[model samples]
Target: MKQEYEALFTPWKIGNLEIKNRIVLAPMGGTCIFGWMEPGGSHFDKEAARLLLKIAKHDCGLIIPGIAPVKDMLGGKWLYQNKRKFAELAEFMDELHATGAKMFVQMTAGFGRSFALTAPLAMLAKNKALNTLAKPYIDAEYLTAAPSVLPNRWADDVTTRAITEKEIKDIIYAFGETARLCKEAGVDGVEVHAVHEGYLLDQFTLKYTNKRTDDYGGSFENRYRFAAEIVKEIKDKCGDDFPVSLRYSVRSMTKAFQYGAMPGEDFEEIGRDMEESERAAKFLQDAGYDMLNCDNGTYDAWYWAHPPQYMPQNCNLEDVEHIKKFVDIPVVCAGKMEPDVGAKAVKEGGIDAMAVGRQFLADPKWVSKIKKGREEEIRPCICCHSACFNLTKHNGTANDQDLTESAGMCKCAVNPRSMQSKKYRVKPTDKPKRVAIIGGGVGGMEAARILALRGHEAEIYEKTSELGGVFIAAAAPEFKEKDKQLIAWQKHQLKKLGVKIHYNYEVKPDSLPSADEYIIATGAEANRIPIPGAADYAMDATDYLLGRKQVGKDVVIIGGGLTGCEIALDLFRKGKNPQIVEMKDDLIAVKNMCLANTSYLRDCFKTNKVPVYLNAGVAEITDKSVKVNLKDGRTVELPADDVIMSVGYHPIPLLQAAKNVHLLGDCKKVGNIRSAIWGAWDIAMKI
Candidate 1:
């Protein structure tokens, strides 16, 4: 074996089991799941198995699946019922084992407070009428306790009912049963999904959400009982030698602390703070857990856990460092640990192992790339949270949205090979062809790279002196450095594939060059907003942002989409309080930014005293000032040194008369980073 690859290939032992490598595939779900007792009844879905198998083939040391319900049919749950199908699952597991990786099924309980009913469940215990109204929305057996008693935050009217002693016993039994099933299914190990703001276990574990008066609640000892009991059950049932890991969040920055919504005041729940994480971790280790999977945040107080693009990458590293003090067992750190950071974490003793969730989704070959000393080739996750958290709000189910739309499977911003693994693998053809891609942005770069990799002669023509197109301007805003990672990764891939690049060159329909095929990836430009005196005082957001033009002091930014909000923040950073006026009901309307990151940005605005006027439209612009119309039919005049317009962007003019030309990127439609990249991927695959 090559010396550079030795680090990843070395084996590491956990308890009695030895894993082939140091790489661990962080857990994630790509399809809807339920308990065995739900409406559809839990059955093995072959699609999920296939996806897992694909991940397994990547040859990571450990692979952890997302939450597998232990309570069977606990209402509206997507249960795992096909115990007999273990043989099929085992085939994938065996394949991974063959590759020197160990597969683990993650068992979870306590999803009662997931939906809106969690609020009502709490309200029901306080008042009966609210329970009756919430009953319609409640799903499954809430096990022994009601959703309200579950530790989480929701609208003021919602609350959870307390759990009885018998219910606690039932919860313990569920873990044991779930563990036994995994042991029989031939998994190398089992992981307890006691993290996040999920079902029963966490409901009782988190202090703010757990309000029990019994031995299971109130004090730290009482709270530790829930997770401890489950861990004991798994060890007892799975046998002492079985490798069992416990995943838990050390920090609970719930919404109550960040931005109290509905009926509560915004305040962090100090009860479940870092100190609590340390205590829980030690308790779990003592209870016979072979390892600790360190995770953070919850759905109720979503941001504290998920964070967002604005939050620094590796936000949870500090928490991991804190947990390491109390536990002697291996601590696996998760939450946006990229390749370099993860590799550094290993060297710095931040944790025993690094868990990658969104990073792997952006590129399944990440670990492989890092091991091969190809660090720059690793695709970076932008942490946009569009496909992960934001989409779930609209579809009601995370899996339904991810597999169908949100970059299916993996989440590379500029690569479409995510969930479409089996459907779209790289293949070679007998005959190669010549291809021309016009544009140097994400989409055009992706197309050109893919075409060249497939043994085709690919040439790229970018109209500007640079290649990134609007992305160069997009990265100009505050905290959008990760977006640059996407551009950098794409540019690297394009260069490695030997794709020819021609900058500052535009293509005309009338004057064209003959090739096997032409892909029009001409990106979009800032929309011309019509308002009097706009030209004199206003500057396009892209121009001012990309450094193509400069803005004077005390600026007014028009159009409150993602670009505008980001620009406003950047301006704020520069000591300028840019007022943003939007015609829409909300700011940053189009993008699915993470709630936690967005909350932090909102806090920044408040901190900096920057004004964001939603539902306010620009009426006209004067050289000295601008007039605006509020949604309430009120008009106001505001003085401004300059105006930055981010109303919208239109496709670059790709001579429509061009024949045998396929259009992609901003020119095809004004879409997101994923759309542009996937457009290129799809077009190149066909060519």
Candidate 2:
């Protein structure tokens, strides 16, 4: 093992509890042992529990499940009312302890105004008749309360009223009751979820969000009183010796209400600054919290809390380290944290531990790989947030994900068997058969791996020298280092599984390979616009990414979907001026797109002073200039040293009617990694 990672395995104390290692699995939505953000009765989620148990068996030291909402998001039943479920939790904890992992139940007051309200729920809140009719089952206003009457982070059409003083006390009581129940249920401790992420508790802490004259809102102490009181009540109920960690954001990192400060941007903070964080860290510690599970961000600065590939590694490390000085409690930082860099941070005593989230979703055996000196074998989290926290937004909708999908959050984009252990798992196939998968993209590789694991001969036919289809271009950007790592990991896995690889071999539709099954994964081609002189003047998006074409200083990229936006960002980073012309109202305004990734890209364009024309289209392409129709009614000619086409793609399934032939990845339909990978897994398991 690396000397730097030694600190990670060292024992650490949280109050009276002795944790065997400094590694922590930070909480994420839908992976909660006690049910995720589901809209129903609060109970033990066996699916989520099974996922955590697998992680525990992988040798994790401390595992914190996702938020156990103090007030149920669905039926408004207080969590304490579900006391019967605590018995199941006790038994689950017993099993976790056998693996030498201490579990912490993360209890939350609520999302309040920061809640990712879907369109249907927003409509329900707007209509008095509908709200009254749905009152027994759901209450939109109660679920979306605020510290003060404020504009909701999700919808501009709706405003959330201030949470009543009586309601605050009730929630505090709920916290104490929940903590007491957790201790009795054999849990090691409880972590408050949090005066962070600009949630209900956090709204009270931030001056901009809290404009109340009540005892719980004015001044620093009053603003903090709600959280402090919750801590005191929990300690009183669970015993003062019982450990309690606070999930804290060291700095809000917001430029203003509904705005975020870009990383390294020296903007005046409109939310909690570092100076206030230092004082608050001490105050929270003094109030009897044992440790600080820290990061940086608010709902406004979503990227910092839920970082994407665009954000740098260990983005919140400096701010967290600074906060550690003001308090004696152990501090852990989590924000796109790299294992090696985080281990270095731990070794230097900058932070006590590293709290990893999405990586655990990608690979449960991540820590075991590190401990066994097999760091290269660990699957990297690309931080796409496509399957995990994909709370999408676009024109005419606050959130695009359906309610059912919203409930089953935190599924991995790359790893299909994350929370879906019940559905997708490798149980040795009764009938082993030869499988030939065309194309070497992510989906093809995934299908090959699964088939190989199931005692089948799986062979991949790649036209290029290497695997990774369109994903090769996707991972080419400097910011996509992890995506590159993921590609390498996939290739390594395929080789280890003994899957046959025939490089530079493209199977033709006419001469199909002799196999039990054929999987078509020949990815889509970039759609070129049909403008005049486009063939001579405009370059394909994939060609530009593969470095086949070099554009001059000024580049205009057509299409503002995720691909085009990412390409534009790459172009800008490489000392080139890039302008984006999109037919959509916003960049990457499509479903299943995580807000964290999209917001970071959006912020980058604004921060770097890049030009983006939305709801616009290209009219014609010239040698050194291009004509465009703006969102309004104006048509203008803009200088374009080069034009990259990224409009969209069409499926290119080679043998759609062939017997026993399956279509996967882009060849079937142009979709993101999730659809491709999951689609491959779904078919592979059946065959």
Candidate 3:
């Protein structure tokens, strides 16, 4: 290991529980032994256990699974009601200890208004009769309760009511019992699921979210009393020696209720600022919490808590380091933290430990890789929230993610076998054959790499001179460094696996290759609408992204989808005035787009004063101006120095007549990197 990284390998302590190293596998939803957000009885999640064990085997120092709710998501019973689950956890912990890793069960009070309200819950909330009938299984309204009445982040229509004092008391008692149960289960410690990310506990602590005259609201002490009581109660039940950590936010960085202050942007903090965080940090320690797993941002500023590639690396470090001075307890900083940066911070006593999240999903063996001085082999997490935690809101609907995607949270976009190990693991093929992949894009490359790993001779034929098809353009944005790195990693892996590459060579239907199997990953073509003067006045998204074309200062972008929004934001960042026109009610109208990602872009647009015209359509384009049909039935003429079209794409597959031919990626259908890569893995494994 590098000398700077040596600090991360050193032992650390939270109260009396000594961790093997300063590396903490930060909690993530669906990674807990207890079922997460699933409408089922609290029990040992074998799948979660399997995954956690795999990570543990990779030499992780400390493992904190996803925050397990005190109250069941489905059943009316509290977490303590499931006694058998504790026994199972004890057994899992015993084996986990054998791998030299200490485990902490992160227990949450609840999501409150922060709950990603799905379609079924929305139905239950609207239909009172159905809600009452479903009470034994799921309390829709109760599940959606907040510290005070507030607009739901997922949807404006559903405002969550205030959580009653009685309910708060019940949860406090539950935390105590939950800690006791965790101790009985031989877990190393318990971490409070948080006064962070604007969850139930955080809602009470933040003045903007909590508004009441009761003991749990109004004053700073009152606002924090709920969380304070939880740790105190846990200590009373589990003893002071029993370690208790708190998931904390060093800075909320919220400028408004649903607006985030982007990194390095000077703005008034609407939520908890640094001064308050300093006091709160000391106060939380005084309240009996042993450690602070720190980060910045709330649900309003979701990107900070769950940063995309756009956010800065070690984004929360400086703030977390500043907060560390206020408390003596170990402070771990999360949020796009770099290993070397974290090591330097730890070595200099800026922070005690490094808490990482999605990187573990991308590569569970990352810790082991670093330990073996094979850091380059560690698969990088691009921080795309596609397969994991796709809490999307669209068309005035809360939680627009599909039911299956919603159930399966904390997945990785690049690693298809992350959560589905049993189903997707590579096996030795009895028969090896030559495979032809007709595209050097991410999907085609992924297919080729996996096929080669499975003992097949895989060769990629690229029509272009380089690998990474549309992904090259997708990674063109300056903020997309991680995406570019991912492409580099894939290329490195393909070369390492000795996969043959045929560049600048396109295979046609008439010119057939003598391979056992063929995969067409020709990707997609930009969809063009029949608007007047489109050919003359507009630049396709692909052409612009590929740097083949440039736009003028005043740009009117057509479409408000992810691609269009991204283009607009990219252009705006580059000192171009880009206006968006969309027929949708919201910015990102598509489902399964994570709130963490979309919220950042939306907040960025708002913060930077980028003009967005929703519920509008482009009528026509001219040399001097672009005509837009506004929702109010007014035909407004926007200055048309340039027009960028990013409506969407259509599949373009080739060589489909071959007997063993297959299709994947955008060529199969318009989808994301998760779908494309996973599709490649699924088909490659079958062959």
Q: Which one wins on TM-score?
A: 2
lDDT per prediction? Answer: 0.67, 0.88, 0.88
Higher-ranked by lDDT: 1 or 3: 3
The residue-by-residue lDDT of candidate 3 on 145-222, one tens digit each, is: 998888877766778888888998999999999999999889999999898988889988888888888998889999
What candidate 2 gets wrong by more than 4 Å, as runs, is 36-39, 657-659
TM-score winner between 2 and 3, please give it. Answer: 2
Residue range with the least summed lDDT across 10 consecutive positions in model 1 = 394-403
Q: Write the per-residue lDDT of candidate 2 for residues 525-606, one digit (tens) a residue.
A: 8775678879989988888998998889999988888889999989888899999988878898888788777887887898
**Model 1 Cα lDDT, one tens digit per residue, 471-524:** 888877767777887788888887778788988787787766668788888778
Task: Provide TM-scores for the models.
Answer: 0.84, 0.98, 0.97
Q: What C-alpha root-mean-square deviation, in Å, does candidate 3 show against the real structure?
A: 1.5
Model 3, position 398: C-alpha lDDT score: 80
Instruction: In angstroms, give how far residue 248 of model 1 lies from its true place.
Output: 1.3
Candidate 3: clashing pairs of residues? none
Model 3: residues >4 Å from true position, as ranges? 657-659
